[model samples]
Target: MRRVLIIGGGVAGCATALALHRAGFAPVVFEGHPDSGEDIGAFLTLAANGMAALRELDAAIAVGRAGFPLHTLEFAGGVRELAGHRCLRRAELCRVLQAEVARRGIPLHHGKRLASAAEDADGITARFTDSGIARGDVLIGADGLNSRVRALVSPGAKPRYAGQQVFYGYSRPRRPPCEPGRIVMVRGEAAFGFAVSPGGETYWFARVSTVESPEPSWRESLLALLDKDCAAIVAATRGPVLGTNARDLAQIPRWRTDRMLLIGDAAHAASPATGQGASMALEDAVVLAKAMRDTANPLEVYEQLRRPRVEYNTEASGRMSARLPPMDVPPPVSEEELAGQLDWSRRVELTAAE
Candidate 1:
């Protein structure tokens, strides 16, 4: 039996472990957090491809709990339907993955922040801040966007900020909520806001175009900017803010050195503009697992099989990103506009950028 050590137990890490186990290989997972049950305050969409991968891990039934069908998505003039869509809470999604992993008797080590790693021809060894170490015939870094493992693998793979920033909020329905049958996206100049469902929890992400400002510390500077653009969604929130810098990286030419390889965000990060980050990462995990299972030289197989997918997705995300407008314009600009934003009788229509 072959042993694998995987770093980062978020969506990508847990999925990879489960997939590997089903492929007759069990992988030990290391999560930087103190526990495997904390909520990340974000929801992810499991597209067709992603859903297929989870089913392969025997996790679809559980995944159903973590996610509702994201069947409909709409884009329009800054305020899409306030309701109607299949959604789930981010917490629910993680819980589902973690539960499946536990049921399989997979070992998961939390609070084990990766400190350093060295890969030899035979295997790879990883040192953690928790004063522990793990070694395996193969090492995979599923650590998220800011992947420490990636740094060690390809030092030159710097993340280029995707000139967009998103402010996310979690909330419950107030009175009659936005229509509940679709993922709603409101588009405007250099900004767009969306409402999504995860674990039955309502989630919103507001993106502001950073190209106009060109500032590295734009998050601080653009506080007012986001607030203005995402007025409708902001007003509807009933929970704490789940925020982070929106950024992405394509790939590292030398993703593998000996028995180690990088996967998911560590290898490539697509912009969230197209909302495909989670879906693509899911594909990366399963694709890599399949490649490894089919070949003796897992590294070579994983590299060749996943590179094209990563590159294609990366380019698609960038192209979609370039079409977004720069931040600066405010929404309806008043509570009255919010009230009169959409008429129930009139049909609202949206067209993607040409």
Candidate 2:
């Protein structure tokens, strides 16, 4: 049996562990963070394709219980409606995935940051920042945007910023304004989005176009960006806000070497605007595992199958990022066009990943 070393205990890594385990491999997941249930990230929307991938792993019900399913997504004051979207706290998603991993008795190590790695004809050895080492027949990089493994595989590659930053926050209002499972988005100066979860918590995000970082804090930046039309959202959200830069990797020329492979954000990160980051990572996990199941040269086959798909998403996301209009201005895309994009994204199929 091959011992697979999976780097980064994130969505990609955890899902990969589960998939690999099902494929008859003993996989160990290494996480740089000491704890997997850190409540630090914002909410994530899992589209239909992502849910389908979870269903492939028999994980849809668990994750669905952790998130809110959206029945309607309205943009630009109800000009269009997007279907088949779901929302969940990113931390909750991680907690649920980690719990599933624990239930299966998978070996997961914390504080195992990858400082470097080297490959031999027999296998690969990963060295951690803490001076620890682990050897396995296969090494998979699931580390995020600044993946150490990525730098080693493609020395010239780096994350490309999307010229925008997003601030996300969850607020419990005395009375939620939006209907449960309904999401509303407005395009002005910047983009302001609001949605009410099943638990009655309102999740909101504001995306502002800027190369320079916002001042005061994420919450302050959000309050300042919203116009009078969205004053209610500004007034409703009083809790702490989390911020993340929108970024993607454009046409990465490398994804694998003998005995090693890269998956998820480590290989091809897409902007949040595309709403494909989490879903794409989920797809990568299942597809790579299937490739492993079917071939002797799994890394090569995985790269061939995944690169074109992720590259297409990367390019689409880049185009979306470039289309963000100036502040206080309305978006350039028409209602029909916006709806078309949303529908297209939701329709992306991952059944083949199973």
Candidate 3:
């Protein structure tokens, strides 16, 4: 069996571990964080494609327990019913996935930040900041945007600002503007979105175009940019607002070496405007595990299958961040083709073009 060393125990790392274990590989996770509450203040939504990937790993039900389902999207355009989506706290999702990994007796070590890695013909050894080491047949970097492994794989591949600042917060409005299971998008001077939970809490996020970093009173500045209802929601926030610069890796010329590979945000991170970061990571886990199970050159095959789709998302998201109109770019793959690619029972296959 191939022993896979996985770095970063966030969404990508945990999901990769579960998928690899199910495919009969020995995969161990090494996380830099001392605990699982790394991004406790942030929240995200898993679209239908992401939910489908979890289902392929048989983990949808376990993860479904933490988040509530979202069924409708309301915007300047008419409302539309969604296929299958879930909204939840980022830390809560990590907790659920990590708990599932533990339930299956997988090895997960925390606070062991990756320092460096050396690869040989036979295997690769990962050295951690804690002076710990592990030898594995291959290394998979499932780290986040500021990934250390990415530096080793492709030097000078840094994250570029996607031209926006993202802010997140929760509010308890006595009278919620929208019903539960519905996400309302407000497109004013800035792009804003909010979803009300069954318990009457409102989860909202805003993306504002800006080159400079936000000030200490970003909340007040953001309020000034929003309309009356949106401003009211921000004013009624339950706690301090959380904000961050939107960043992404527009392109990475190299994704792997002889015995090392990059996956998830470490490989292809898109801006939050798309809201496809976690979903894309989940899809990577499933496709990569299948490749490892059925290919002689798993790394090469994995990149061929994933690069086109992820790059398309990166480009589209960047355009949205810049407040540009939608381009007529063709999708990398059709929904039917993607379904076939993610299907676990079927053997992995790629078209001639891919």
Candidate 4:
């Protein structure tokens, strides 16, 4: 049996473990986080392509049951509505995915961060920060944007700041009941997006061009920056703001070595504007596992087919980020242009390895 060692226990690592397990490969997942049930993050929308990839890996049904789907996504406060969108609590999605991984009996080691990896003719060996080691026939790097595996493969590669910062939070208002089935986005001094999930909880995010992350009062800061209409949405919210710096890895020249492969953000990281990061990771997991099952040189096949697709999205994300107008200004891209980007993102589908 060919044992596979996977890094990062997030969406990509867990999905890869599940796919590889189904493909008759023994896979062990290593995560830097210490808990198997650690789910802390902002909300995310798993567009159609992301949903399709999860269906391919048999992970979507479970996720759908746990998370709600989006029937319509309204941009610039209903200026445009994109059909077929879904929103999920980031923590909930991780919890569900990890549960699926556990149900499949895949070995997942939390707190096992990858420090370095060494490859030879026989196989590859991964060294963890805790001094633990793991050996496998091949290693899959799903460790995300700042992947150590990626550094080992291409030392020159790094993520570039996308010139945007985001804050996320959940709100429940008694005066104005939360409405479900629509995601409303408002563009003004900054970008404010909010959607009511099927569960009636409001998930909102505020995007600004601040290079330096705001203080703990992120929500208040965002509230102050937003226009009165958008500010009302955040002002009615109640919770701590989850802040994240947006980054883009334009493209990577190398995605694999003879005995190692990089998948998910490690290989190509797109900006949040695309809403395809999770989808791409899910797609990579399924495709790579299928490739491994069918081909002797799985790494080569994975890279050849996956790189171009990821690079295209990365480029598109960069362009979209660059086009975002300044505070209190109109969006650089028109509704038609934004619709085109949405179309491209929603149309992404996974293909089985040849």
Candidate 5:
């Protein structure tokens, strides 16, 4: 079995570990944080495609327990039923995935930040900021946006702001709540979206166009941009609001170097406007593991398979964040084709033609 060294024990890293382990690889994960609580303030939706990937890894039920299901999406047009999408805090998802990683007895080291890495003909060596070292036959960089491993894979590749600043917060709305399991998107002075959890706490986010990022008084500034109902949700919130400039990687000329490779946000991070970051990362985990399981040249095969779909997502998401009219973007891999690709029992090469 190949000894796989995985960097970043977030969503992508943990999921990658689970997939690789099931594929019979000896995978070890190194997390920068001392615990699985990074990004506790922010939440994300894992789309149907992501859930499908989890089911392939036999992790769906464990992960499904943390968050509530989202069945419908409401917008200016109309409400449409969703396929089994889930809404949960980013940290909660990490913790659940990390617990499963532990349950399987996979080795996950904490507080081990990657300072640098060197690869040779024989293997790859990872040096940590804590002065620890691990050597493996292959290294997978699941590190997120602002990835250090990305610098090694594709030098000068950096994430650019997608022309929007996003704010996230949770509130118990005094106003009448929307139906449960429904996500509402409002297009006003800014792009806003919210969902009421099963517990009645509303999870909301606002995206505002700005050349300069907003100040620390994000609540007041954000409320000013929302309509009455949206403003009321923000006003009822009691805690600190989380905000950041929406960012994405336009393209990376390279995604692999011999034994080292980048996956997830490290390889192709899309703007949050698309709500596909976590789903895309989950897809990467399953596909990459399948590549490793079936091929001698996994790095090359993985890139060829993933590049088209992920790049399409990156382009589409960047356009949405910029508030630009949608262009004739290349359509991503079809749903049926992707399902065939993610099927664990099927050999990856057989699905390549679809």
Candidate 6:
């Protein structure tokens, strides 16, 4: 069997492992976290294309079990729809991916922090913090926005903040019937709020106009900022929110080097502006794996398949970022203007496999 090593066993990494395994490759996922289930909290929208990709990896059913199925997508800035997807919980989605990985007997190594990696003409070897090495015929960087493997391969490429920051968290029902299954978006001055997830709990996040993203101290800052952005969400989601300050990233061009390849956020990232980050990442994994499976010279196919798609998404995200209203005042947009906006979401090949 073809052997592959995946770095950063987060969603992208785990998803890559699942896809590559299904393609008849032996994949080992190395996660920096101590375990599979960790404190990482965020809700990812499993848009149809993303959902289909997960099904290909045989992870979608578990994903559905972990969270509620997403039914709609609503963009509420002056109350308009930009894009919609079936959304889900990030934590639960990870668990589902874990279950899929385990079901297929894919190896998962946690707490094995990656230090660096290099590729030779013959193979690739990744070095971990403990000075251990994992080698394979090919190496994939599934690490997220801040991908270590990417830095080593293409030092020039870096994740740039899309001029916005977000603060969000999850809260159990302090108030029920917040209209479950409905993704409610509130467009306000210099901010936008949206709520959706499984179990009737709301994953609320508010994006603020800012140059820098919120740092580790952002959770406390988010507590206060969210109060200003949308109080009802702050109240309804209740206490103990995941508190991820939103910071979208854009990748520098040039995604591949030699036999090593990058996938998901490793290659490119999207702003929540389009609300398709997770779906895009899932699509990245599936496309990368398919290119790898069908072509012997995969580096070319990988770049050819991934660049246009990532570029299409990055461009769409850029458009969305520019559309953000002044942080204190909702942009003056006519209902017709808003209504005339193009829906750039992709049409998926639903029959990928489950």
lDDT of each: 0.66, 0.78, 0.90, 0.76, 0.89, 0.66
TM-scores of all models?
Answer: 0.79, 0.87, 0.97, 0.86, 0.96, 0.81
Order of models, best lDDT first: 3, 5, 2, 4, 1, 6
1-354 in candidate 1: lDDT tens per residue?
289898888888998898788777979999998876446666666665566566666776778755566555666534333221235555676777877888999998888889999877777788988779888887888887778888888887877767666566665544323444466665554354455454344566666665533323423443455445355445657756655556788666678777667888788888777666666666667666665565556666666655766666666676667663444333222424212211222221211120
| Model 2 lowest lDDT segment of ten | 340-349
Regions more than 4 Å wrong, model 1: 37-39, 76-86, 172-177, 196-202, 211-230, 324-354
Model 1 lDDT, full chain set = 0.66
Give the runs in model 4 whose Cα sits over 4 Å from its true position: 37-39, 76-84, 174-178, 214-217, 324-354
Q: Indicate which candidate wins on TM-score.
A: 3
lDDT of 4 by residue, 131-171 (tens): 99999989888888888889888889999888778778877
Worst 10 residues of 6 by lDDT: 341-350
The TM-score, computed over Cα atoms with residue i paired to residue i, of candidate 1 is 0.79
Off by over 4 Å in 6: 37-39, 74-85, 172-177, 196-199, 213-229, 243-245, 324-354
What C-alpha lDDT does candidate 5 achieve relative to the native structure? 0.89
| Pairs with steric clashes in candidate 5 | none
Decreasing TM-score order of the candidates = 3, 5, 2, 4, 6, 1
**Model 1 CA lDDT for position 76:** 57
RMSD of each candidate relative to the true structure: 11.6, 6.2, 1.5, 5.9, 1.8, 7.3
Misplaced by over 4 Å in model 5 are: 214-216, 350-354
If both were scored by lDDT, which would come out higher, candidate 1 or candidate 3? 3
1-354: candidate 2 lDDT, tens digit per residue? 289999989898998888788667899999999998245648889987777677767788999988878888788656445565679888888888888888898999999999989999898999999999999998999998888888888888999778878778777667786899888888887788888877787888877787845442555556676787465665677667777777788878888888778899999998887678988888787777776776666777667667766777777777666773334534344445323322312322233333
- Per-structure clash totals for the candidates: 21, 3, 0, 2, 0, 11
